[model samples]
Target chain A: MPGSTLLHIDGVEKRFGGFVAVDGLSLEVKAGEFFALLGPSGCGKTTLLRMLAGFETPDCGRILLDGTDIAGVLPHRRPVNMMFQSYALFPHLNVSDNIAFGLKRAGMARDEIATRVAEMIALGRLEGLERRKPNQLSGGQQQRVALARALALRPRLLLLDEPLGALDKKLRDSTQRELMDLQRRLGTSFIIVTHDQDEAMTMADRIGVMNHGRLVQVATPRQLYEQPASRWVAEFVGDVNIFEGRIERREDQRLVIACHNTGAIVAAAPRQSLAGEAVCVAIRPEKMKLSRQGPAEAAIQAGAINRLEGTVSNLGYLGDISSYGIALDAGATLRVSVTNTARVDVDDFRPGERVVVWFEPDDCVVLDP
Target chain B: MSTRQLFTRPARRAAIAPYLWMVLFFLLPFAFVAKIALSQSALAQPPYLPTFDLTAGWEALKAAAATLSLDNFRLIFSDELYANSYLRSLLVAATSTTLLLLLGYPVAYAIARLPERWQPIAMVLVIIPFWTSFLIRVYAWINILQHDGLLNQVLMALHVISAPLVWLSTDSAMYIGIIYSYLPFMILPLYASLAKLQPSLLEAAQDLGASPAKSFWLVTFPLSLPGVGAGVLLCFIPIVGEFVIPDLLAGSGDMMIGQTLWLEFFANKDWPLAAAIAVMLLGILLVPLLVYEHIQRRQLEGKQ
Candidate 1:
């Protein structure tokens, strides 16, 4: 690992008696990156975050921060701070005192502590309510107090465990933006743990998706969405139409796959080996276009657009886009999204209407079945 | 009245029953005591008839009052012997309460931190000592604190002590008995309050760069103050009136107000003076009770 790597978790594992909670997880966070550990519940995302915060010790790994092994370091001794999911603002302390708590613990002089606390209070936009206890503040204000308290220490790495999980929808959205902006302004690395895919997509520079105590994939949100590494990742990231198949022919960068259920030949990018082997072709909903008629140059070009005839089963109107669930002739349903441009009446397409769904060869990704 | 009005009567009566019970059980006894405190001593006796004569009651009050005559108050306070004993009792009780808090806090914290599966068992263990008789538990302390007692024997064998030290009939023995008798009172409430504390608060403290000790003092300790207040009041108020532990552990040396009241009533057979002393003790105990109630009420209002 490079010296600039802020956090290095190497082969970290945790077990509770007979069950493994975190199994041989290893990852690196750069100095100023907004990293996210994203997964569903019980996927070890929070457990990994706890280990990084020093609340949990890994059963079998070394955790390095700023190029030094911190496996045995206590949470208080570490140069990292955490913001809890509940925004664990001290109910007894007012906003200023709560933010000043960490500085006081560090034994800073009284004047310096006061100045820093005032600066943090202003930074959090809590200018006047310094003497109001946490119970008197709104949920968003309490969250800001929590943030100010954590940031007062100026830690090398900041860990947030579902920081926005407690807020209402509007507050959470705004706070998510504010947190990203704050991280950028401070140039501090943040490792946020969340189960919400949208939260991970909105704020993270890189996301590590975990499943059953294993890191399935770590990539940028766009990369994870567009080029999922496995069948699980493909289905997890977004709405995708997956067709189990075997590769029938191999071209330069594309493979002709014969889908098992639909019995249709489709062309996809050849990323994984599948010649005469079982595989699955995954195409995003927005990548597939629904047309009333087939394309004109369908069969002539190499890797031509594959067409599937299907009747619309369900239509979802989402203001900006309309999603159509097309029940194909092979009995497998395929989702297709179309932008609602110019306030067109085409979004009112009902069920039982026959439509041809087509996607380019580059739009579909081939993975091992 | 309408049907709704008729139905509301029964609901209101049911709601008022608990308050009525409290008044009957608690306030009624205090009222009787107050009435007795105001009556003439002769009239306060059996076949009691309270005459509403201001002269006789006023005389009784004046006689009981400690003017330049520190005679009655001096009977308990002026003598260095009695004064030292009272001080010793207070010192013992205060020390025991402090020890109980120190020992009980970690036990409560440990029990609270235990997994849900283990919590009930831990709580049961803390409560199991209360099932035994308190007198028997105090007697058990006597057996352990005696000169040739198990503690001394073990310490002697370990060469920690050269001889069998005089452990019984000492202030230390009295403290041990008091703490052993009242420990469960401290632990249960502390455990209950500490158990309800959100674990996220501790995590938040750690994340905010607080060390474990600092976090505990700053967050956990202050949050559990209500329980501490409850435990201290429960232990202190009762122990302040305690006569049994001192009598059993300290022979004639550890005389307290309860023992003094007992001697004044039964030994001296001075009914008027005993009643006067009883009234004085009541006044002493009531002040703390009132202060505690006021504090508790203010706390409740703050919460609201």
Candidate 2:
């Protein structure tokens, strides 16, 4: 509805007979913004993307692009293109021809099609491989060809369905950066659907986490990580230590949560629910600290820096950081991540060692249970 | 490598067994046909000779050549009747093959797109006609197409036609019979090929701004060419050698090569002339077979 909005989906719903794939979903993607619809399988992320591309029409709502309702517009008539999860490069067509397919379909002049195809090949760094078919190219090269084909049309908006799902980790990482760079360079509005949280976090300007055909939260990656709006969002985004608790007191800005397991009062600012009600304390694992000694007086003085005693059950070595699974006395496990700064011999904390895990009051999130 | 092992054992067996079978079934029969072509008929001992006399056989051949000569081949080429029959058969087969492709493609596409539960059912429907007699099916077409037949009766009752049309004993009837008889051959391979087509290709075409029709022509059609080619070959090759439909529907009015060969063998009682005609027919079929193989080899090589 705003001037910056490039694509608008108004209460779009999709159903296959009795099964509701996407239900009354509404969202707007701003111009020149990289928006990601993040969800797991069967979460309606891909269905929403298909509706945007005009492959699947919404049963109940309208999809508008550039302020025009495109409910009845055919996929070819729409000013949008999608990069399918499988890449779907035409096996019969070579790289150049695949890139030039849309242009040729539009009956463009030969010279113009050739020039645009050449430009796309250059832009995709697919030079000298124009004559090679899709099966002849490597996975990454085929991905580039698919991307080139979708981008060649210069659509107003681009829909990418799990764009990097087919690549290996190392290649995915590099290609993710390349895609972000390309998006920025083109300044085209992009709505990418992916299940990978890290991919959404790393690539998107704003991430819309979806669950059960509903948008759980739409915010920047950091905001989503730090201030998730629901228990689903908190758990879906990252590894969170959720402690069942009841609210003890209410303040204007924060609420004091009395956790049952540790018998510790924790402070968290409730974003939605009122204080003095049942809530869950959601603290990110990486935000917690593990120490041989007890927590500092300052942390305890902050009204409820919940301290817990646990035995290290397992250790995970992750290059720059190490994670320890602390089995608490309450029969719950708390994961704590520590930075691996130096080659300290004491960094390798073995199993069965008693440790104290603590986090600041501000690090814990108060969410409705 | 596993491939080498797999091929080596099979290759060794194939190399010896096929040759043995070919010698037993093919070469020996050809030798028998050659012997019969050369032998002289005896009046007393049921057309047997005590010993083979090569000169007598040569003289018989020369006499037959003098009488029969290239006269049959010349007659086939020059006589407007024979020329028209040949051309009509070609046209009928070609048109039937085209119709088969048109009807079979959508059926194949539907079967391919059907859900997993319905796939076997669809496949069974495609194959069910094979369990029945082909002749019965062609005869059924006669019942549907003949004057005052089921189709005409229905049409007249519906006020669609004032009179029954003469649909039998025509090239159109021959076309319908051939197409009906050969439809399963066209549909089965097409279904196999179309079923294997990835849906993502169509999605990609749509995502690239090509309309559904354009996508079908540029993407779906070209990719399915191998199936079309296979279906055409499956229908066309056998129809070229077909005699039953022409005899049943054309009623001796349209004499094809198969009918000609049949007449030469049965009515003329000239075995050597029949063999020559057979050889000519074999020549005509073999060239196309070799060409098809060459084209298939090139296609395989291109894929590699």
Candidate 1 regions exceeding 4 Å error are: A1-4, A272-276, A297-303, A342-347, B1-18, B43-92, B113-119, B141-170, B266-279, B294-304
Model 2 segments more than 4 A misplaced: A1-3, A250-255, A297-304, A344-346, B1-91, B106-123, B140-166
Roughly what TM-score does model 2 have, to 2 decimal places?
A: 0.88
Which residue pairs clash within candidate 2?
none
Q: Model 1, range B1-304, lDDT digits (tens) per residue?
A: 4546766777977878899999999778766554444433343444223433456777765555422132445455555654564565566667788899998888888998899899999889888887888889888888998888899999999999898999898877887788878888898889988998888888777766677888899999999988998888788778877888988987675587677767866786544345545656666667767888898897665544
Task: Write the residue-wise lDDT of candidate 2 on B1-304 in tens digits.
Answer: 3546757776877768888999999888976655544443334333423344467877776654443234445544565754565556566667788899999899888888899799989889878988888888877888898887998899999999898888888877887788778888998888888887888899788777777888888888888887888898888778876888887876556677777667756685655545545555555667667877898897766566
Q: What is the DockQ of candidate 2?
A: 0.59
Best by TM-score: 2
DockQ of the candidate models in sequence: 0.51, 0.59
**On residues A5-29, what C-alpha lDDT tens digit does candidate 2 reach at each position?**
8888899999988888898999988
lDDT of 1 at A198: 91
* Docking level for model 1: medium
Q: What is the lDDT of residue A16 in candidate 2?
A: 87
